[model samples]
Target: MFYAVIPAGGSGTRLWPLSRAGHPKFLHTLTGTSASLLQATVDRLGALADPASTYVVTGVAHVASVARQLPTLPDANILVEPSPRDSCAAIGLAAAIISLREPSALMGSFAADHLVRDTDAFVEAVRAAMGGAEAGLLMTVGITPTHPETGYGYLRCGDAVGDGPVSRVAEFTEKPPYDVAVSYVESGRYFWNASMFIWRVDVFLGELSRQQPELYAGLMRIAQAWDGPERERVLGEVWCTLPKISVDYAVMEGAAAAGLVGTVPGDFGWNDVGDFNTLGDILERDERGNVVIEAGDGPVSKPQVELLDSERTVVVPRSGRLVSAVGVHDLIIVDTPDALLVCPRNRAQDVKKLVDGLKERGTSYI
Candidate 1:
């Protein structure tokens, strides 16, 4: 059986103001659609797997929101993390729980906040990964890079693994400098590491046991108590003790070290949609290169009002709000009810610094 595990514990800090503590980025309707990023992820999974086979791994704090957003998903499918441990523990817990029921299940681990344009190509790429997983290979989809993006990690492709659409993983590189990223792209040897992994439950568990023994032991303790009457209580206690390491650092990187998994090319028009700037780039833009999202009430007044000689600038005004820009070129103006973000078009990735400063000030309201 094919199952999907959506990890929804990340607090998309980069898209602040619109993305707050109470409401994460996954819950935001940035695409001008009624559906949220989490709901969109679940919908994407529905196209490939049964709704019954899909699971959402999220923090206990987000349980109610996740449940409210996806009422159709089975209640048991919502795997609640007691605390924000990290992706490694979150995915390990999901694998353990799902494996308890379906030993031979092929589970696909995905981030809950990505923006994918081509659903059909995504499904096809996943099918190829499933085929590779069936052959005992921990398969990860490597996105064909459209640019020399330093924000994402790259996966170097090695030899061809099988006749199917999988290839041996050459190596994994974390986010590198601009020169390295450029060299990787120019060499035509690497793809953006999308972090979308597929493998059998036991295969991942075995790798965890081999590499992260301490984490595996902790997971075993929780797995042993997963079905008990004290399941929730036990989970709460155990979650706080798990380390805050990512799955890539703990497992996938280790798998590459042990020569167990392979990297496969995927061309699904994938974008992680990490920030508001990226969201603008992924969606349609006007002739002025503006991307707007209107929510809450009626259409935003002056949605595309031009000011003094500002060409090729993007202005996104919150509904029921009036926003005007003047003397700005190639800029992004995101005006929300609570906060307004104005930045140069090319410096969108640096918005995270503002979030860091806000966090430092203990402004929990975002």
Candidate 2:
């Protein structure tokens, strides 16, 4: 059986004010759906994997909120990390735990806050990736590049693997300069690295051991105590010691070098929703191209947003008070009870700077 693992660990600082440390972006309903992004991720996983077998690796602070959001997930399946240790550790822990239970189970790791417009295409891509996974190769879903996107990493694919659409990964490239990114798109061999990987738990753990032996050893030790009374104690002692690295750096890159990595191309309207501008792209806009997202599900009343002569603007009002914009063009306005963020839509990625500036101001502001 295929098990889906969602590493729910990012704070999404680029989406700040609306997305806070206490309440991250994945917990918000950014897609205008009744369910939050975390719930949406689980719901998407239900297309291939059973909810009972699905797992979410999130931080200690968000455990209660995650459990509250996904009531159907067993408490045991919600693996709580004492602190944020990045994607590799979060996914590695889940892999180790699943290995102990089902050694040969296939697992797919997907982010919690991404938006996939076409679920059928996503499932088809995942099924294709599973072919590579069953063959014991580290499989990743690569999005067909719609444009020369300098912000995302690129995967240079080689030949097809075993008569399938899946291809052998030639090289994994970091986010390139704009000129180089344009060349990558023109070449057509490059695909955006979505970080959606599928592989057998045993195969993944084996690769982890081959690439990052220390981390693998640490995870195995913790997994040994996972079902026992010493689970908390062992996890607390070992988890923090893990190297703060991404799975791309710690394993996938090395595995690609060793010719064990493969990728399946996918183009189903995927958006990472990293910043307000990208979020605006997926959201419904008015005739003048203004997108307004009202606060919902909170104890507070719906926030009233009034726009006057605003064009191509994105307004997120969470403060319950009426937010009125006058003569603003191509701007992003996000209001919370404690903070207000106003910047040009082009500068949406810099929202993290405001979040960082809050650190010097006070914890209450953050």
Candidate 3:
């Protein structure tokens, strides 16, 4: 059986005002669907894994919201972290807990706030990656790059693994310079790192021990007490102590260097939705190429936005007040109850700067 592990720990600083510390992007429906991103992620996994076998690792603040969103998930399956400790700690702890029950079970970790236009292809890709997992190799899903994207990480594909569709991961590259990104796309051997991982519980724990021994030891202790009365005490004591690092840097990079990592290249129309510009690109646009997203889950109607002579603009109306745009071109305006963000559409990725400025002021908006 395969187990699904979801890491919903990011605040999505780039998507701030809409995504805050108290309410992350995973809980919101950036997509046109009625289901929130987190729910959509779990729903997409239903084709391969059941709700009982799925585990969501989220922060203490959002645990209640996660429960309300996913009622079918057992309370025990919702592993709560006392604080945000990066992806390695969150996903490692989930793997540790699953190892206690079924050491050899194949477990997959996917982010909670990504947009997948084709669920069918995604399921197939995960199934393809499973072969590598069964062979004791760390498996990751790689998206066929359509363009030279300097924002996302890249995974260089090596030789095929055991007559399977999966390829050995030659090297893992972080967000590269523009020139380097162009070369990667021209080579055709590089694929966008989708941050989707599948591996046996035992194999993953073993790799964690080999790469991040301190974190592995802490997770094992917490996992041992997970089902007992000391669950809260042990988690509280150990979770914060684990180093703050991403699984890509702490585990996958080292494993790839050791030739124990494999990837399945797929073109499943994947979008990380990390920034407003990317979100605007995926969402529907108006006649003049304007995208307006209304806040709250309300009936569909004409948006409360009035745009005049606006082209390629993205506006988010959440304050329940009509927003008027005049002579704006390629601009992003996000109106919230407590904060308002206005910047050029090209600067969407820099929205995190506004979030950081607010945080520096000790503002309550974050």
Candidate 4:
């Protein structure tokens, strides 16, 4: 069985007011389902990874809440970072620890907040990717593009590497311009980089040592002391010294250049749930195409909202007060105890701008 590592370290600023610094978007159930995104992610991978083999890498601020959400998780499985160093350090640390325990084990590092609707299909894709990883290739599950989505990074796919259901990752491209995204979709050669990666722990650590020598060295030191009494001291000394970089920049892109990277084409329904508009699309809506999300304590099955002639809108009622909207179309209304967010659906991705402004003002609402 493959070992699973979940990196849950983002504050999710795009979905502010509802997603705060202490309580992030992963903690909230954006979907109508009872499980949060983090819980859903763990459950989705349960068929492949047992509780002991699964590890969650999170920040000091979220460790308690993460443990509370996942009662079955072992205490040792929760790896806490001293600070927010980026994805590279978080994932590299997990890889290093897993390597010491079982060098040849297949370690699949998945995001803690991504939504995968078809758990069966996701597991099948991971199994397919495992074949490539077993063959000494770094594997990633590439999501099939549905439209000209410019918000996500794109992966350029090439010819098949081997007989297994995996292809060589030709190139890794960041979010491009509208025309470039359109061309990518029209050419049918690109897949959205959802950041779900699978590979042998030893193989991945070797690649990391090759690409990010300094970062890898630091993580190894921390990992060696992880099980001992010097765990916290080593982590404190080495973590902050490591460079803050993403795995894409530190490893994957370089490995793809060396022809050591492959991917499985995953067409399973996936959603990043980055912003309110994306959440609005996933949730249930009214007859007039208005989605009212009920949040906070108490039995909030139905949202206390009154939408009049509102079409294609999203309303989040989190403050236990009745929210009334009239003739407001394509708008997002999020009401919290201390802050209220009002933005058009087209500007949903720009909600982080408001958070930025509030942060500059040193307000607690952010």
Candidate 5:
């Protein structure tokens, strides 16, 4: 059986003002649709399996919002993490739960906020990755790089496996420099590390036991308390004690070193949707290259606007607000109810540093 575990806990500080502590980026309807990123992610997985087969691992803070967004999902399927323990623990917990129910089930770990255009191709890629996992290989879907993107990690692929399109992962590089990324794309030897992994429950658990014995022991303790009323209590204890590490650092890297590697080429037009610039790139931009997202109850009035010499810019006006731009070029103007972010287009990625500064100053307005 094929099961999906979506790790929905993420602090999307980069998309601030629109993404806040109470409402994270996954809950934002950046596409101007009624569905949120988390909801869309769940809907995408529903095409591959039943709602019962899909599980959401998230923080306790967002449980209510998640439940409200996805009413079809069962309440029990929502595994609330007591605290943030990073991806390794989140995935390990999901694997442990699936192992208890279906020993032979193949689990796919997905980030809840990624954007993909083609659901059909995503399903196909998942099937290919699952096939490798069923054959006792730790499988990951690597996207064919469209450009020399230094923002994302790259996976060096080895020879083809049998007649399938899947390839053995030669090595994993974490966010290489510009020249190296360009070389990787030019040589046709690397793919963008999408972080989408597929593996059998027992296979991942065995690897965890072999590589991270301490974390495995802690997971075992939490798994043993699954049937008791002390489940949440035990999980809280484990959350505080387990080391904070990503699954790539803890298991996949080690498994690759141990010669158990598999990969599937993912050409599903995937993007992390990390920030507003990426969101603008993904969405349908206006003639002026602007992407606007409006939400909540607000007055709508069209104001006469005239642009003198604005070129190559994106202007997003919040719902119920009148915005008029004049004589602006190569700027991202994001006007929200609480905060307004105006920055050069080239420095859009660095907005996260501004958010970090706000966080350091303990300013909740951001």
Candidate 6:
């Protein structure tokens, strides 16, 4: 059985106001569909895994909302962290728990805020990765790069493994400069690291134990108490003590060095939706290349929205007020009841700076 673990613990500061601490980016519907990103993630996994087998590891504060969003998944499957520890701890904990449940289980960890336009291709890539996982290899689903993207890390793939599409990971490169990224894309051997992985529970845990023993030990201790009376107590005691690192740094990087990592190249239209610009690109655009997220609920008339001579602009109105834009190009305007943001599309990634400023000013706005 392939169990899916979703790590849903990001503040999404880059998508502030709309994505708040109480309700992060994954909870919103960036896609045209009404279902939220988290819900859509679970929906996509349903093709391969049972709802009961799916687990979501999120922060304690967001537990209630996560549960509310995914009622089909059992409450016990919603693992709650006492505090934020990066992906290593979150995914390791899920691996440890799955290791206890079905010692022979296969599992995959996917982020909660990704957008996939091609569901069939996504599922096929995951199924292909499972073949690599069965052979005791750490498998990552790498996206075939469509452009030279500097925002995401790149993976160097070597010769194909066996007869399958899986390739041996040559190296894991960090996000590079524009020139370097372009060269990588031109080589055609590099892929965008989508952070999607699949491997047998035991295989993953063994590598994790060898590479990140302290973190593995902490997770094992918590898992030992997971179904017992000491579940919360042990988790509270050991979780925060684990090293704060990402799974890429803690396990994947080392596993790649040891020649134990493989990647199945994917071309299933994937987007992380990290900021307003990315979100704008994913949303449906008008003839003038404008994406308008309409305001108001039910059949009630929406507020007046005028976009005159606007091109490639994103307008979101939630303040129940008219939003008029004229001669604006490649701008992002998000208005909520309490907060309003106006920024250029190129500066989308820096929206987090505004949140940091909000923190310095006061926590109330945030």
Residue 305's lDDT within candidate 5 is 33
Residue 184 C-alpha lDDT in model 2: 94
Error of 2 at 217 (Å): 0.2
Residue 317 deviation, candidate 3, in Å? Answer: 1.0
Off by over 4 Å in 3: 300-303
Those runs of model 6 whose alpha carbons end farther than 4 Å from true positions after fitting are 295-300
Q: In candidate 2, which residue ranges exceed 4 Å CA deviation?
A: 296-303
Residue lDDT tens for model 5, 1-366: 788999988778777767777788888777656678888889888877788989899898999999988899988888888888899989998898888888868999888888878889999999999889999888999998988988887888998887898788888788889999999999998988898999998999999999999998898889778878999789877768998898988998888777677899988889888777777778776687655555522434564233446766666676346666677877777777789888887778888899889989999765
RMSD of 6: 1.5
Give per-residue CA lDDT, model 3, range 16-104, as digits (tens).
89899999999998887788999999999999999999999998899999999999999989999999889999999999999999989
lDDT of 5 at 115: 84
Model 3 scores a C-alpha lDDT of 0.91
Worst 10 residues of 1 by lDDT: 296-305
Clash count, one per candidate: 0, 0, 0, 0, 0, 0
Inter-residue clash pairs, candidate 2 = none
Candidate 6: clashing residue pairs, number: 0
> What local distance difference test score does each model get?
0.82, 0.89, 0.91, 0.90, 0.82, 0.89
User: Which digits, one per residue and each the tens of the lDDT, describe model 1 over residues 1-366?
Assistant: 789999997777777667777788888777767678888888988877787999999887789999999999999889888778889999999898888888878999988988777788888888888888888888899988888888898888887877877987767788989999999999998989998999999999999898888888888788878888978777777778888899888988878767777867778778887776677777767766666665524444454454566666666665346777777777778777778888887877777888888888997556
Q: Mind sharing the TM-score for model 2?
A: 0.96
lDDT of 2 by residue, 307-340 (tens): 9998999988877789898999999998889888
- Tell me the TM-score of each prediction against the true structure: 0.94, 0.96, 0.97, 0.97, 0.94, 0.96
